[model samples]
Target: MSKNKVHYLKKLEIISKINTQGLTVRSVSHDYNISVSTIKDWLRLYDSFGISGLVPGTSIKYPNEIKMKAIEDILVNHLSKADVLKKYKITQNSVLNHWIKRYNNDKTLKQRGVGVRKMNKGRITTFIERIAIVKEIIASDFNYQALSEQSGVSYQQSYSWTQKYKAHGEQGLQDRRGKSRSSDQQLTETEQLKIENKALKAKNELLEIENQLAKKLLEFEKDVTRSL
Candidate 1:
């Protein structure tokens, strides 16, 4: 037992002796080197419920391990909130509130901070120049890390820029922060439609080439069969 526990047990034993032997509180406190008020308090507890009441009243609010385990099981196993609460000895509302708060904070953190550097005209222009250099390096069959080193951009940033460029084209290179709808002067509707149509036509031509190659292969097989 801890020193505190030993002290508590000694106090209880002293109080028990005073109660049974009818020893005075002042005399017992002086002999035991304990306070008189402390002896009085112990005797009061002893009188109230005998030996059990002499033990310290537990005021510590220990968290329920079963409830914590239940929460863990619910999260790890994807169990329903009601089932988790029932298994863990916690209220349904407590479990729901805890998870909802956790999910909301996680989502808020994602939306609030992305850890990317703030963009400006200087940064945007530098990024555009680097992007051009990266494209040139890629055409020459340089790897992503080599392009990153050549462009003075991290590999992850270079990869992210490549994806953004693919998704939004040249406009993606422009700084978007603090910009409004008025700043967005993209290609006209007719121009966008024309570009899309041209891309579709290119895709169709590639597919046609592949189909012709397949037919040529079949014809070559037929000629070989005749020769055999």
Candidate 2:
């Protein structure tokens, strides 16, 4: 809270203690008076971006194709979040979370630009406004287009925010554009089933939504033709 940025060496020192000494992140947080999340971010950034990831205000741009493929891996190929992080060399967990947010809600992967300030796709919205929009979207059974149009926010922003709120509550909406590679753990059968089921459910929902929209479009076209 006191320092806006911690030096890379200092960040490295803290991370080293955890990695080498096996010190708990909590202990390091208490000793350094830094939040546990901040320390965790540094550890991940170090793993992914090395020293540069630990640097304050470091912005890494991910290409759109890379983002889309990563999303497909997560949603369709059933890759774990941690695995996707390593595979893509994504700088922060938050970056992937942001991408997942868009994918889950909209059922589409939109192109994302790079940079800390301008990376997000939509126009600016306040925390309070996001909460309101998210709540409305949930109430409408996640009708992102309706809520986005009503709120004058882009559909992508509405979908992204709503997805986060649904998954992590209000805290998820906070711009956490924040990463690490630990040893990969083997999944049990039950865990494997859960991952597959989740992906299947997402795919099913997407298809259902698309079908309903297509039907409505066809009906509208028919009505227009008859009236003319």
| Top lDDT model | 2
Taking the tens digit of each residue's C-alpha lDDT, what string does model 1 give over 114-205?
23221211223343354464454344333444445555655456556667777887567555679653434455667555545654564566
Query: What residue pairs are clashing in model 1?
Result: none
Cα lDDT, all candidates: 0.51, 0.67
For residue 1, model 1's alpha carbon misses the true position, in angstroms, by: 86
- What digit string (tens of lDDT, one per residue) describes model 2 on residues 1-228? 543477766887889899999999999999999998778767766777665566567787765557766777887789988778878888777799998788656533442322111233367765556766676666555655545656777656886787787799766766544413222333356755554565456557767976996686567546644643
TM-score for candidate 1: 0.25
TM-score of 2: 0.38
Evaluated with TM-score, which candidate comes out highest? 2
Pairs clashing within candidate 2: 44-179, 92-178
- Please give each candidate's TM-score: 0.25, 0.38
